[model samples]
Target: MNQLKKPVIVAFTIITCLFSFSSCKKDSNNNSVDTDDPASADPTLTLVWSDEFNGSTIDTTKWNFEVNGDGGGNGEAQYYTARSTNAAIKDGKLVITARKENYSGKSYTSARLTTQNKAAYTYGRVEARIQLPTGRGMWPAFWMLSAKTPLEWPHDGEIDIMEAVGYRPDTTFSNIHCTAVGYGDLLPVPDYGRTYHVYATDWTADSLKFYVDDRLIVSYANAHLADATAAYNQWPFNHNFFMILNVAVGGAWGGINGIDDTIFPQAMSVDWVRVYQRK
Candidate 1:
């Protein structure tokens, strides 16, 4: 979540609040019921935007290729490139390949794609079906960051819908990073590298829920808002955020356990990415 270093500590403080009887509406039986409860009336979801990767080439209008060799502030070994070899659409899937080679003074080459200025959303349900690559040093992630100008890391906020380090091929992580706190949750997907899974997050003003294959794994609420000391740093999800998909090579968490050079060519194949909003 730190972007520079994955936090080693997993500390989460969950605060629960009781529903106020005064806010409840009376039912036919004179029973108090919260009509505004999300469970009582779930909104219908409408597909607002999506990319099935059915085209022959990457859709430049929707995605931007980020080319950099800055290590992503985490000592990553790969240089992100815009070349087709690093990122391309094939067989109805978006393939992001990481290759071990001598390129631009780096030992690895990978791709990073984002929907920054081209598209951004405030709150909704975002999901992606992806098949990950395995072997140590590989780090694949589908995440989001604030789209606000003059980007601020950890301050503007970050949401990691799915992150898998090759060392732990069976486990995937979801996390939220803000100035107030950074917490993460993990889910085990057997044979993750060989299978495809839907990683998603339902974000609203009240909470953020993460899921794998539609199974809920993590639920983070805006509990800090009730505290008098809380500020924008505690909850910065009110603004627009852009999505990012990438496979980072050996940096921080992914590189903690040394990389296995034998696995030279690894790739993350994305089947589709869809965004839905309550209609």
Candidate 2:
């Protein structure tokens, strides 16, 4: 009887061990995120700056309003307003709304928020989690500009982390704009207006890698910008750059087809903006 009982207990122990091992394997697999970038999972990346938009109001210390309606040289229709109706913080997110209403002689009103003089960084991983607004002429962008004074645009280099046109709901863009390399690639992704997606750029002295949700989409190298004759023309990114977030209506890109007045009061919702640097 004692021998029979010992066999039964050993058999039960073996089954229990196998069950625990299988459960552990399943949990490990489930915890993994679909990503190719090593830094996406690396624990060493330090959060240098971030805005979660937790309060009832936007933190003025971090962002300033680019209040104007001059079309930004793009023939945009929206008059960018500095009022809370156009830009506000609610439900733990920064909401930039574009409305089809007359304001200051413009047919539409929107908001452009910037971190120009308030915050700037030279190189790091800059990203934002955003859900785009939808409409015929809606154009939303999360981009960067040189922090230098006198505001040289393309000469200073522009880094468009994310740009989406409402006419093309299935595509977005990421590009490095300079005199030498001034082109962008259209990336087709799942409908960005339907859900929040992360748009990010990993920038270093030698390269700029664009990513969507940790998946690398395109990479632009600094080899062309390294030429001494074209350094100023191409590599103005050596200095710090500040970020801008805005939604424009009926601009050059968004107005390609024309504005659909029915989609009034469209909004681009930003969950958060984060900047991480190597530790």
Report the Cα RMSD per candidate: 11.1, 16.9
Please give the TM-score that candidate 2 achieves against the real structure.
Answer: 0.84
lDDT tens readout by residue for model 2, 148-233: 89876667788888888788878887877776666556677657988878889999888888888777778777765446767777
Instruction: List candidate 2 segments past 4 Å from native.
Output: 1-41, 224-227
User: Tens-digit lDDT track for model 1 on 1-279?
Assistant: 236757432431011224573223222233222232222133476556777787799999999998999887888889999999999998878999999998989999999999999879988898887989999999889999999889888888999999888788778988999888887788888677887777899999888999887788888888756664475777888889999999999998888798999997999999778777777
lDDT of 1: 0.81
> TM-scores across all candidates?
0.86, 0.84
Where does candidate 2 have its weakest 10-residue lDDT segment? 1-10
